[model samples]
Target: MINQSVNEGKTAAIISHFWIIGLIIAFIMNMSKKNYFSSFYIRQMIGLNALQFLNGWIVYKFLGGTAGWIVGVLLFVLWIISLFGAIKSEEKLVPVVGEQFQNWFKNF
Candidate 1:
């Protein structure tokens, strides 16, 4: 079952990690398939993009250069980790808010 999901959804899952455009593309690709694997990464991308927006608005605006940089790096690392897990056909959460993302975006 796991291997089958990876086979069917790998392309969409990888594309979903590339930010908004990729998220849209992956979503379209998964529309017919309704792939669990693709949906999982799509939810992750949604949350990550929200974090990106917050980083831009709140972190960069109020936190100053050093703190903003730190948070930015951390978010990037989380993205990389999640992307790598997708590549490896793994379904691990995206660190802190991953579970929340899954719960909140369950309808997707």
Candidate 2:
């Protein structure tokens, strides 16, 4: 069986969710091997970032700092779990949006 663990170059996937810099790193890493999770995870991270970006308008825009803090913390936790799973070579999805990401970006 193919080792499911993210390999040497695959580390990019786990780090992609940290911030935009991580996304750039992932992009560079994936430039040579497009089929790797490094690429797919980067795409997923971008999607997640976009979602969070839009979240500010939906909840934080009116609820203010308190709601933003709650939502931000929740997103951070999910990001950590997904990053850890990816690093450990597991295909576990990130709760509600995990499966959707995989399906939406299947072509990647």
Instruction: List residue ranges in candidate 1 displaced over 4 A.
Output: none
Q: Per-residue alpha-carbon lDDT of model 2 for 2-65, expressed as tens digits?
A: 4643575467887787788887877777777664657667767876776688667776888887
Off by over 4 Å in 2: none
RMSD to the hidden true structure, all candidates: 1.0, 2.3
Point to the candidate with the largest lDDT: 1
Each prediction's TM-score versus the true structure? 0.94, 0.79
The collision pairs in model 2 are 5-89
